[model samples]
Target chain A: MLVIARHTLRETVRKRLLLAVVVLTALFLLLYGVGSELLARQIRERMLTNVDTALPLAASMLTLMGFYITSFLGALLAIFVSMGSVAAELETGTILTLAARPIRRWEIVLGKWLGLATLIAVYLIVASLGILALTRWATQYTPPSPVPATALLILEALVILSLGMLGSALFSTLTSGAVVFMLHATGWIGGLVEALGSVFDSQAMVTAGILSSMLVPSDALWKGASFYLQPVTVILAQNASPLANPFVSATPIATSMLLYSGLYLVACLLLTVRRFAHQDL
Target chain B: MTVAIETVDLCKQYGRRLAVDRVSLQVESGEVFGFLGANGAGKTTFVKMLLGLVHPTSGVAHLLGRPIQDPRSRLPVGYQPEQFRLPEWMTGTETLELYGQLSGASRQDLRVEIPRALERVGLGGRGNEGVRAYSKGMQQRLALAQALIARPKLVLLDEPTSALDPVGRRDIRDLIRALRDERVTVFLNSHLLAEVELVCDRVAILHEGSVVREGRLQDLLKTSTQLRVVVDAVTPAVVEAVRPFAHAVVPNGRSLDIELLSPDHVPAVTRALHDAGAQIWEVRPQQMSLEDVFIGIVRPRENG
Candidate 1:
């Protein structure tokens, strides 16, 4: 099993797609750091003109910028890392040789998930560190704490990766990636829709938005991460409750999604094993 | 002698088509059993079923006297599939070592045997080279080496010589024959009649998912009493004179083609042809080649 896992990790890590992700992430980080450094230097210089006004607002905006940047990059990495887990193997018949071996099907699935999770973990650490490093270097700004934010980002990535892998099992690679992307996109859309409905007092629209969030809770998790990472005073002043509006706040993902992911992995593995066990060579 | 592999009423179906009908066969230890058939004749399907690469619809297969599905049974069988696809980026050595390890070869054992296995298959120092760089024949040799390296009790080869050149064919045949000397059962499928006729101790001809004829090579070719005689001259008198000893003797200007009743009549027919002022050039008994037998039996059934 370790042999299988090691080989899978090595083979996938060598993929040009993953390499491209690494290159893009590195370039983005360099740009973000350099750009933010310039912006902060200008803000600091402007602070000499208006000492009280510029600094605090700039610090707050900097924190928000870090959150937005990290969240988007995390989501992209999670989706890209797992989109091809099953579908690519099925397409290339690479899985056939391994599945035909004495190893159980679920072991193959678990190994793949573990390998992808490790990849996601690496990207999360690098990107979060990039954000933290940029903020410190640019503005002498250090947010209260980044550990919670980084943890939340990692959790979000894990959830997305699991969903993407499940989608891969059910649909072709392209379809699965598209579905995961759409779910992530619409989950954010639903949050916006719910905010509009509440402000305008549209009961029917509010309910519709809430139901959409329940259907795919990716945005709910992201919103929860937002709550976890934000200073407590901000939430109290805004009267924002993660649970009061499931569409906008990241509530703890239901126990069912976790259970569903476990089941999904097992089912995908069994289907692969049974189908490939007797596959005509 | 113990049978290395045995199948009882093995049957397989794909949708409405019976790919391999009820077939039973036994390949004993130290015998090279040729599975002869045209394309689509269940040779591949049968080999798959035997190797546990595919499930038989209804049958029992025993490898090394244990049930085929039993984990223990599979340990003693090494298989090289007909249309095998290996990882393109893997070096030939890596591919062999991986499979060798999977087949339960110890690292210590692999160290001593890996290079020799490569050399035997003509990929000796090329193990580190990626499979994509290898030609079709070289890839095939590497595949064969992987199959044989484990030195399993039985090697299930499908179309083992199909794409090989004459030299490669001879090498493979020799390797297969060598396996028998090691007391390994060689169960191979091939369309090459001469290959089977030369190396097989016994062969079964499959047609339309059924075994049409099967026996030892000597037994399959043993039944012939016809004598073909070539002479310097052939005339009506020579045909008429030889007619008494042959079922029919037609004069073809230079030779008298005689289909005789028995081998005893060959000498008399030759003497009669010679006595009729015909100079005898050559006289020999007609023996059936595998091709002749295959065409003779399969064509009529196909036509009908």
Candidate 2:
């Protein structure tokens, strides 16, 4: 299993997708960070009056942008990296040589998942730290605790990788990628429904949205990250602040969702191993 | 004559199609057994079932006296599948090491065997080259090297030399033969009649998923009935004299072509030919080549 993991990690590191994701995310942070800082400076000078909320507002706003961008890009990277873990190996016939050996199929699946998870964790840690450095250097603003948010972001990336790996096991790459993308998109949109339900006293809509979040749990994790990154002042803001919108705050994920994701991945791994074991090459 | 591998009414199905139809075979230890069939004749499907890659529809297979259902049974078995694909990103050395570990080769064993195994496959110093850079033959050699890494007691090779050059083929054949000296059983699946004829002690020919014919190579070929008669003078009396022993006779100055019912009939025909005034030069028997037997069994298309 170690050998398999070692080889898999080597191959994955050689893939351009990892470097591409890092470069794109850094470019995004640079542009978004510089532009937002310049705009905040302009507003402060134009008013000819110092606003207490200016720095906090800009810091929260910039963190929110970084969070959103990382969440979306992290999910994208996870999906792209993991979508072909099983199906591509089977299709390309590489698994034939491996399967013909005495190694078990479950070991292979788990090994691949481990390698991909490691890659995702490294990306999240490095990129999140880079974003934090940018926030400090450019705006001289720091959120309450960046470490917790980074940890949550790592978990989020893992969940997404699990989803994509599950899809890869159940279907071909094309179909798997499409289905996972839809699940992600729906999860994001459902976050809105859950938020609106609390404002309008719509229990049915809230139930539907909560159920959707339970189905994927990705949106719930993002909302949790938002709550962590946003300040208490913005949470109570009346003008529907972008950083801590009340609608986004309403649906805090239940503990059960994390268990579901874990169980979901375990089930996916079991099914994949079973299917792959008997699969004729 | 202990059987190293055995299948008891082994069957496999792909959806509605019967890929392997109630096949049973026994391969003795220290023997090279050839599995012959046309394309899509269930050769590969049967091999897959034996390797437990594909679950059998019904029945069971035993490798090295243990049921294939037992994962441990694979430890003593080695396989080179026809459609074998190596991971392109892996170097040849890394690939062999992986299989060696999976096969439970000891560090001491690997230290001595890895390099020698590569050399046996003509991949001596190219171990660091990625599989993608290797030619088809090199990839096949690497596959063969991996399959034989552990000195498995039984080796199942499917077209083991398909992509190899003549020298490479000879090297593999020699390696296979060497395995036999160590009491290893070799189950070879190939359409290469010449290779099978040269190596296989016993062979089973499959046609449309069923074993149509099987036996020792010599016994199968010996079953083909033909007469070879050499006479100093080929005359009408000699032909007429030999007429009762044959279905038809064609006189060719020094040779008399005779139809034979069985190989045993040759002695009687020779006696009858000697009874006549003609001088009998020599009496011989005709044996079918593996190619002849192959073509005879696999019914060719009308146009073909």
Candidate 3:
């Protein structure tokens, strides 16, 4: 299993996709830092009516954007990287050699999962945290919850990767990506629905959002992260505001959803293994 | 003698289509066994079932004296899939190293065996070159090297010479013979009748997901009853003159295939062609080749 995992990581790193992702990420991070620095200078020079609200809100907004960018790109990366994990081997006939070996099919699944999981972990720590560090260097303020919020973002990306693995087992690589993207999109749209529900104080709308989250808890995880990143005082003040807020969850994610998300990831991985184990090459 | 492969009513199906129907056969240890079949004849599926890449729907198969259900049964087996692809970015050496690791080769075994394995397949000094730079035949050889690197007791090769040039084909044939000489059991699955006829001691012809014929090469060829007669000019009159003695005559260009009622018709056939003043280039008793036997079996099923 370690052998397969090591080789998987080596092959993945050699992909042109990773090179492009890394370069684009670095460039985006640089530009964002520069933009933040300019905003910090302007904020300091200008007179602010309420520094408390202004300072944390500015920092939280930047941190929130950073989280969104990293999470979105990380999801794309996971889908693209893992979509071909099993299907491509089955398609190109390369899996024949490995499948003929004395290794179990589940071992192949576990090895590939571990390899991609490790890659996603590194990507999150570097790309997501790098953005946070850049925002901090430019502005003295930071989000209230940095570590846990990033952890939530990482879990969200993993959920996508696990789903991608299941799709790879169930469909072609292109179809898997397309299908997993739909699942990811459903989560995003569900988050919006929940955010609207929170703003409108509608139980039915929140119920709809909860239904979608049960199917894929990616939105729930993001909401949990947002609960940490958003300013409490601002959210409290916005409660009486008339306009709609995208999403401002005052409470963290339900412990049940978190537990279910963990199970969803495991279920995807297990289903992939079970499906491929008895499948014809 | 020990049995290298054994199958009893082994079957595989894809939806409504039966890819490998209930088929059973036994191959003795250290024998070069050819599995002859046309495209979609379930030859590949049978091999996969033997290797455990495809689960058998029913019946049983044993490899290296162990049931195919056990993963360890495949540990000492080597397989090269038809038209396999190596990671294009990996150098040949890296490819071998990776396969070695996956196959559970120790570091010491790899250090000593990889260079020698590369040389065995005629890619001795080219291991550093990336697979992207290698030609199709070279890549095929690399796949073969990977299969043989571990020196297994059994090797299953699927269309081992399909993409090779004439010289390359000869090299692979020689390699197969060498494996035979080394007492390695070979399950050679191929549609290349000529190549199989050259190397295999025994063969099985499969069609429509069933093993239609299986036996020693010479024995199967001997079962063909049609006699071939080559003449310089098989004109209409020459065909007419021999039609009386021949049960069925199929004249194509300079060759005439005559179905014989009895072996005694050879003299009458020659006399009839001579009476018509046709020059007979060759009139010896025609023996069945592998191709003739294969078509004889597959033609009926294909027509049905």
**Candidate 3 — which residues are off by over 4 angstroms?**
A48-53, A230-244, B223-285, B300-304
- Candidate 2, A85-144: lDDT as tens digits: 887887777777677667777778788888888888888887778777777776777777
What is the overall TM-score of model 1 with all chains considered together? 0.80
Off by over 4 Å in 1: A47-111, A139-221, A241-281, B223-285
Clashing pairs in 3: none
Interface RMSD of each: 3.4, 1.8, 1.1
Model 3 has a DockQ score of: 0.59
Error of 1 at B266 (Å): 11
B276 Cα displacement, candidate 2 (Å) = 7.2
**Candidate 3 lDDT over residue span B1-304, tens digit each:** 8999999999897898999899999999899999999999999999999999989889899998899989888888889998678788888998888888777888889888889889988899999999999999999999998888777889999998887899999998999999999999999999999999999999999998999899999888766457677888879998898787767999888989888766667788788888898888887567778998888788877798
| Candidate 2 lDDT (Cα, 0 to 1) | 0.80
Clash pairs, model 2 backbone: none
- lDDT to native, each model: 0.73, 0.80, 0.86
| Model 1: docking quality category | acceptable
